[model samples]
Target: MGKWMRSAIQRQKQFYIQQLMQSGLVNDHERLEQWTMAELRREYERFNPAYNAEGGSRHGQTSPRTGEAHH
Candidate 1:
Protein backbone atom coordinates (compact mmCIF):
# COMPACT_ATOMS: atom_id res chain seq x y z
CA MET A 1 0.00 0.00 0.00
CA GLY A 2 2.49 2.61 1.06
CA LYS A 3 5.06 1.34 -1.37
CA TRP A 4 2.71 1.64 -4.33
CA MET A 5 1.70 5.16 -3.39
CA ARG A 6 5.28 6.21 -3.02
CA SER A 7 6.18 4.75 -6.38
CA ALA A 8 3.41 6.68 -8.09
CA ILE A 9 4.45 9.91 -6.45
CA GLN A 10 8.04 9.36 -7.41
CA ARG A 11 7.07 8.73 -11.01
CA GLN A 12 5.07 11.94 -11.11
CA LYS A 13 7.89 13.94 -9.62
CA GLN A 14 10.30 12.48 -12.12
CA PHE A 15 8.00 13.43 -14.98
CA TYR A 16 7.59 17.00 -13.78
CA ILE A 17 11.32 17.41 -13.24
CA GLN A 18 12.08 16.05 -16.68
CA GLN A 19 9.65 18.51 -18.22
CA LEU A 20 11.31 21.36 -16.39
CA MET A 21 14.75 20.26 -17.50
CA GLN A 22 13.71 19.96 -21.14
CA SER A 23 11.77 23.21 -21.14
CA GLY A 24 14.93 25.23 -21.83
CA LEU A 25 13.77 28.00 -19.50
CA VAL A 26 17.07 27.97 -17.68
CA ASN A 27 19.68 29.65 -19.81
CA ASP A 28 23.25 28.30 -19.64
CA HIS A 29 22.05 25.17 -17.89
CA GLU A 30 25.59 23.96 -17.49
CA ARG A 31 26.21 26.79 -15.05
CA LEU A 32 22.92 26.89 -13.17
CA GLU A 33 23.10 28.57 -9.79
CA GLN A 34 23.55 26.29 -6.81
CA TRP A 35 20.46 27.52 -4.97
CA THR A 36 17.79 27.06 -7.63
CA MET A 37 19.13 24.27 -9.81
CA ALA A 38 20.94 22.50 -7.05
CA GLU A 39 17.85 22.49 -4.84
CA LEU A 40 15.78 21.03 -7.62
CA ARG A 41 18.36 18.34 -8.18
CA ARG A 42 18.35 17.57 -4.52
CA GLU A 43 14.58 17.17 -4.50
CA TYR A 44 14.91 14.91 -7.51
CA GLU A 45 17.56 12.83 -5.85
CA ARG A 46 15.11 12.16 -3.04
CA PHE A 47 12.98 9.99 -5.31
CA ASN A 48 15.47 8.90 -7.90
CA PRO A 49 17.76 6.10 -6.81
CA ALA A 50 20.05 6.40 -9.82
CA TYR A 51 20.54 10.13 -10.17
CA ASN A 52 23.86 11.91 -9.81
CA ALA A 53 25.40 15.24 -10.73
CA GLU A 54 27.22 13.39 -13.51
CA GLY A 55 24.12 11.26 -14.20
CA GLY A 56 23.41 7.56 -13.64
CA SER A 57 24.39 5.16 -10.89
CA ARG A 58 27.80 5.52 -9.26
CA HIS A 59 29.46 2.70 -7.28
CA GLY A 60 25.99 1.32 -6.43
CA GLN A 61 25.16 4.36 -4.37
CA THR A 62 21.70 5.82 -3.93
CA SER A 63 20.80 9.01 -5.77
CA PRO A 64 21.28 10.88 -2.52
CA ARG A 65 24.11 8.60 -1.42
CA THR A 66 22.28 7.80 1.84
CA GLY A 67 24.64 4.86 2.31
CA GLU A 68 21.75 2.41 2.36
CA ALA A 69 23.71 -0.11 0.32
CA HIS A 70 21.71 -0.15 -2.90
CA HIS A 71 21.93 -3.28 -5.02
Candidate 2:
Protein backbone atom coordinates (compact mmCIF):
# COMPACT_ATOMS: atom_id res chain seq x y z
CA MET A 1 0.00 0.00 0.00
CA GLY A 2 2.76 2.40 0.86
CA LYS A 3 4.58 1.62 -2.37
CA TRP A 4 1.44 2.15 -4.36
CA MET A 5 0.84 5.51 -2.72
CA ARG A 6 4.38 6.64 -3.42
CA SER A 7 4.10 5.54 -7.01
CA ALA A 8 0.85 7.41 -7.40
CA ILE A 9 2.36 10.59 -6.01
CA GLN A 10 5.34 10.30 -8.30
CA ARG A 11 3.07 9.78 -11.28
CA GLN A 12 1.05 12.84 -10.38
CA LYS A 13 4.18 14.94 -10.10
CA GLN A 14 5.39 13.71 -13.47
CA PHE A 15 2.02 14.48 -15.00
CA TYR A 16 2.12 18.09 -13.83
CA ILE A 17 5.70 18.50 -14.95
CA GLN A 18 4.78 17.14 -18.36
CA GLN A 19 1.90 19.56 -18.56
CA LEU A 20 4.19 22.47 -17.81
CA MET A 21 6.66 21.39 -20.43
CA GLN A 22 3.94 20.94 -23.00
CA SER A 23 2.57 24.37 -22.18
CA GLY A 24 5.94 25.98 -22.96
CA LEU A 25 6.54 27.01 -19.39
CA VAL A 26 10.05 25.66 -19.74
CA ASN A 27 11.85 26.64 -22.90
CA ASP A 28 15.29 27.56 -24.31
CA HIS A 29 18.58 25.64 -24.22
CA GLU A 30 19.55 26.85 -20.77
CA ARG A 31 16.36 25.53 -19.21
CA LEU A 32 16.77 22.23 -20.99
CA GLU A 33 20.35 21.92 -19.78
CA GLN A 34 19.30 22.54 -16.18
CA TRP A 35 16.72 19.76 -16.15
CA THR A 36 17.67 16.32 -14.85
CA MET A 37 17.24 13.16 -16.89
CA ALA A 38 13.93 12.33 -15.23
CA GLU A 39 12.61 15.84 -15.85
CA LEU A 40 13.79 15.81 -19.46
CA ARG A 41 12.16 12.43 -19.96
CA ARG A 42 8.91 13.79 -18.64
CA GLU A 43 9.19 16.84 -20.91
CA TYR A 44 9.93 14.71 -23.93
CA GLU A 45 7.09 12.43 -23.00
CA ARG A 46 4.78 15.41 -23.00
CA PHE A 47 6.13 16.74 -26.31
CA ASN A 48 5.90 13.30 -27.80
CA PRO A 49 2.80 12.19 -26.05
CA ALA A 50 2.14 9.41 -28.52
CA TYR A 51 5.76 8.22 -28.19
CA ASN A 52 6.31 8.50 -31.95
CA ALA A 53 9.55 10.30 -32.67
CA GLU A 54 9.65 9.29 -36.33
CA GLY A 55 7.56 10.90 -39.05
CA GLY A 56 5.01 8.14 -38.98
CA SER A 57 1.64 8.69 -37.35
CA ARG A 58 -0.31 11.95 -37.38
CA HIS A 59 -0.02 12.21 -33.65
CA GLY A 60 3.12 12.98 -31.59
CA GLN A 61 4.65 14.96 -34.43
CA THR A 62 5.54 18.45 -33.22
CA SER A 63 5.99 19.93 -36.67
CA PRO A 64 3.29 21.76 -38.54
CA ARG A 65 0.69 19.65 -40.32
CA THR A 66 1.20 21.61 -43.52
CA GLY A 67 3.83 20.27 -45.87
CA GLU A 68 5.74 23.55 -45.90
CA ALA A 69 8.64 23.51 -43.46
CA HIS A 70 9.27 26.66 -41.44
CA HIS A 71 12.71 28.18 -41.51
Candidate 3:
Protein backbone atom coordinates (compact mmCIF):
# COMPACT_ATOMS: atom_id res chain seq x y z
CA MET A 1 0.00 0.00 0.00
CA GLY A 2 0.97 3.63 -0.42
CA LYS A 3 2.40 5.62 2.47
CA TRP A 4 -0.73 7.70 2.94
CA MET A 5 -2.95 4.63 2.89
CA ARG A 6 -0.75 2.93 5.48
CA SER A 7 -0.81 6.02 7.67
CA ALA A 8 -4.61 6.25 7.44
CA ILE A 9 -4.97 2.58 8.31
CA GLN A 10 -2.69 2.97 11.31
CA ARG A 11 -4.59 6.01 12.48
CA GLN A 12 -7.91 4.17 12.13
CA LYS A 13 -6.56 1.26 14.18
CA GLN A 14 -5.40 3.64 16.88
CA PHE A 15 -8.81 5.31 16.90
CA TYR A 16 -10.53 1.95 17.24
CA ILE A 17 -8.32 1.02 20.16
CA GLN A 18 -9.07 4.28 21.89
CA GLN A 19 -12.80 3.82 21.32
CA LEU A 20 -12.65 0.28 22.66
CA MET A 21 -10.88 1.49 25.78
CA GLN A 22 -13.45 4.23 26.29
CA SER A 23 -16.31 1.73 25.88
CA GLY A 24 -14.91 -0.37 28.76
CA LEU A 25 -14.40 -3.37 26.50
CA VAL A 26 -10.67 -3.82 26.78
CA ASN A 27 -9.75 -3.13 30.38
CA ASP A 28 -6.33 -4.76 30.42
CA HIS A 29 -3.90 -7.06 28.61
CA GLU A 30 -6.19 -10.08 28.52
CA ARG A 31 -9.22 -8.16 27.25
CA LEU A 32 -7.13 -6.39 24.63
CA GLU A 33 -5.84 -9.72 23.36
CA GLN A 34 -9.38 -11.08 23.06
CA TRP A 35 -10.96 -7.99 21.45
CA THR A 36 -11.64 -7.94 17.72
CA MET A 37 -11.92 -4.91 15.45
CA ALA A 38 -15.49 -5.76 14.38
CA GLU A 39 -16.63 -6.11 18.00
CA LEU A 40 -14.97 -2.87 18.94
CA ARG A 41 -16.56 -1.01 16.04
CA ARG A 42 -20.01 -2.46 16.82
CA GLU A 43 -19.81 -1.49 20.48
CA TYR A 44 -18.50 1.95 19.68
CA GLU A 45 -21.30 2.60 17.21
CA ARG A 46 -23.90 1.26 19.62
CA PHE A 47 -22.82 3.54 22.45
CA ASN A 48 -22.08 6.58 20.31
CA PRO A 49 -24.92 9.09 20.57
CA ALA A 50 -23.98 10.68 17.27
CA TYR A 51 -25.00 7.50 15.48
CA ASN A 52 -28.62 8.09 16.48
CA ALA A 53 -30.55 10.71 14.53
CA GLU A 54 -32.89 11.44 17.45
CA GLY A 55 -29.89 12.02 19.66
CA GLY A 56 -28.59 14.60 17.18
CA SER A 57 -31.46 17.02 17.92
CA ARG A 58 -29.11 19.21 19.96
CA HIS A 59 -26.89 19.66 16.94
CA GLY A 60 -29.80 20.31 14.58
CA GLN A 61 -31.59 22.78 16.81
CA THR A 62 -30.82 26.29 15.72
CA SER A 63 -30.21 29.49 17.65
CA PRO A 64 -32.86 32.04 16.70
CA ARG A 65 -30.51 35.02 16.48
CA THR A 66 -27.62 33.29 14.77
CA GLY A 67 -29.86 30.93 12.72
CA GLU A 68 -27.26 28.23 13.12
CA ALA A 69 -26.81 25.01 15.03
CA HIS A 70 -23.70 24.02 16.98
CA HIS A 71 -22.87 21.13 14.61
lDDT assessment of candidate 2: 0.51
Please state every model's RMSD to the true fold in angstroms.
13.3, 9.6, 12.6
- Which residue pairs show collisions in model 3? none
* Model with the higher lDDT, candidate 1 or 3: 3
Task: Report the C-alpha lDDT of model 3 over 1-71, residue by residue, as the tens digit.
Answer: 99999898667666776875776645563454455556555545544667745554344444332244433
TM-scores of all candidate predictions against the true structure? 0.35, 0.37, 0.49
TM-score of model number 2? 0.37
* lDDT of every predicted structure (CA atoms): 0.48, 0.51, 0.56
Tens digit of per-residue lDDT, candidate 1, span 1-71: 69999898666655545644564433343333233445556545544544544565444544342335443
RMSD (CA, angstroms), candidate 3: 12.6
lDDT string, candidate 2, 1-71, tens digits: 69999898667665655565566745454555555556555445535545545633444433322233222
Off by over 4 Å in 1: 27-71
Among all candidates shown, the one with the greatest lDDT: 3
Ranking according to TM-score, highest score first: 3, 2, 1
- Off by more than 4 A, model 2: 28-71
Pairs clashing in candidate 2? none
